[model samples]
Target: MRSQKLYTSFGILIIFIAIFFLKQNFLGEKYQDEHHYLPTAVFFSKEPIPSLDLLKSYGELNTPVPFILGGWVVSVFGENIQCLRLLTFAVSFALLMIFVWGSPDHSKRFFLCLAGLMIFPNYYLCSVYYYTDIFAMIGVLAGVVAYIRKAHGWGMLFFIGAVASRQYMLAFPAAIVAYECLELLKKGFSVKQFFTGLLTDKTWLPYALAVLSIVPWVLLWKGPAPAAVMTMQYYDSDKLIQYNFGYVIYSSACLAVYYIIPEVLITRNLRYFIDFPKNHPRLFIGYIILIGALITLFPAKQAYNPYFTWPYLGYVDQLFMTIGITGFFKQIVFGLLMLITMMRFFSPYFNLTSCVVLINILLLGKAQLSWDKYSLPMIMVLWFLAMFDNHWLFTASNRKQDKLFYH
Candidate 1:
């Protein structure tokens, strides 16, 4: 009862903070997808200009679904920036509710953590913009929550909705496939059960519904080709030929270390003193693959990719802030504790691993001249470390008590 009250208080606090930020004007709200989505709302009721010159010069319909929906919003509520931003604000708030309600273990700390995440570039930027990313993430989070609750049928519906919102959502589907494959392997690939579930399970019904929703777009909306979308139109044959093998090898090594460390720390339930089933290897692997996809999807030349479509980022932002803070006594204590544990357990293999990762980020930032989005992933890594560090501290304390009592 006390915990519930605390969570409620925290939720209200976070919501209030979010409201303040959402309303404040920030440097004129210049970002990608702003132009793309807002105009759909602008010209919805009005007949679209038939001139190919206008479409070519300014607005080429990027995706039909968002435009159609934005058009609907415009028709109902009158076309304006605030109306479009309000739609995003509503979705952002919905995302908060989904995150709070969907959490299996809802605590005050979680809400407080979420409040801190509200300031992340991705979360803040999306909250005030006109884009489908928030909508897509909301669907994905809904699907994840439903899946966790064993409501696979509902989960699939959200999954399909997510994919329909943005086809690049295949990264998440790939993660799901990896997870399911791991489970199947553990069960010795029960063919009869697998086939039966695939054919008759309600979980797959959303996928069926998704097909209905998607078929129209797939058949009628002719925009960019598959190759254009996937390759991001930046990969050049000459660049590939000129690529230095040594540089490639070093960068790859750095990225692997960056992801593997977090996966090892969090996925094993090592921080929580809980044991995950062997059947759930996909949990860690899925996370790793998702991170990899985020990095790779945004190629060197392109500024944005389909990253924010995944909802985990908002919470991940909280994790970053958790690590990025300094000066507080609590922060100092936790930092020392983490430093000691890392030196004790992992230093032998990765004495300079942190430095290497930092160097890679700095180099990448210099190359791109955009270090802001990189903070999203960087902060998540720090949060992963903090979680494990705090877990080990508590575990060691408990073990010490146990030894004293037993002895």
Candidate 2:
């Protein structure tokens, strides 16, 4: 049975890779962040790192590792656009392998999680685009998996790589530290014990290394200039808070519609939401109503649509964008759900893996832009978290065994 399941997963992976290559060929052009990174890659191909002038001009807009990798590929492969994209595809395939390898063996959840990841629109789009997000995510996912498996040295190494891929990935190591601190507290360790653990525990090495990894980048970065300062001035804290909150809710809603709903429908896994109407029917019905209203009232056209545009998919883009509203009632409902999910962070059943997942979500929510690519890591984390048997938030008792199997 295990052999058959593994074979099936391998077959699915092969099919997914084929489809990804087909999409890349069909799309046939670069857009958005690809433009930014490609130029950097070309420069790096010649220079191998940004000069002081380049750093001062670009002002830490792009990080090093992805561009470095792209440079190597371009050097060997003769500067072909497809070659750079092929590198991204290779990195993405490695990411998929890591997820599969880290997943619980002989479990149907492995297949389901892989399916969720492949079918996610952003993951599909990012897989084809020549960008650094996937490369950074490769390190993030590997680091999280290593931490979960208690491989501290490997986790720290991947975390460093992740930081090198993108500066924003510093959130990941910070999340790890937070998780460890919370764990110590849960174990009834005193302040002295906590400090002692930090000094003594091998697991704590990752946290320290995570801090050290930033030093080189800090020394190299030339810092943002006057224009960047002006840009920051445009979005004040009030506006940023509003934008961030709306993005968090809207992105979560999109995740439900694009990924979660489809998964439930295809698998007939109503058990995934067994607690929804059962535990709070009014809240459940209200959420359903809000979703329906959002769909109905969504604008057909928008001035600022950041979504990937495929042929004949403009309406779908508008539909998803409709969730990007910041009305009082919408905020109230979304805030409620956010609160519930946040509460799960304090649950004793919530393990290190769950803590990491929740922390990533929280940090990503604060990001200014609401791109689908930004949410891909969260989707993968959700898939991995689903593999665990414990119900972090919904468990009736600590000792209760209420596993939600995919099959």
Highest TM-score among the candidates is held by which one? 2
lDDT of each: 0.44, 0.61
Score residue 355 of candidate 1 by CA lDDT.
29
lDDT of 1 by residue, 92-184 (tens): 777666665554352333433344345455666666677766666667667656755668777777867765665434334333443443334
TM-score of each: 0.52, 0.74
Per-model C-alpha RMSD: 11.7, 6.0
Best-performing candidate as measured by lDDT: 2
lDDT of 1 at 232: 46
Q: In candidate 2, residue 19 scores what lDDT?
A: 76
Candidate 1 colliding pairs: 320-379
Residue 10 deviation, candidate 2, in Å? Answer: 3.8
Poorly placed runs, candidate 2 (over 4 Å): 1-9, 24-27, 49-60, 215-219, 222-243, 251-317, 320-348, 389-396, 399-407
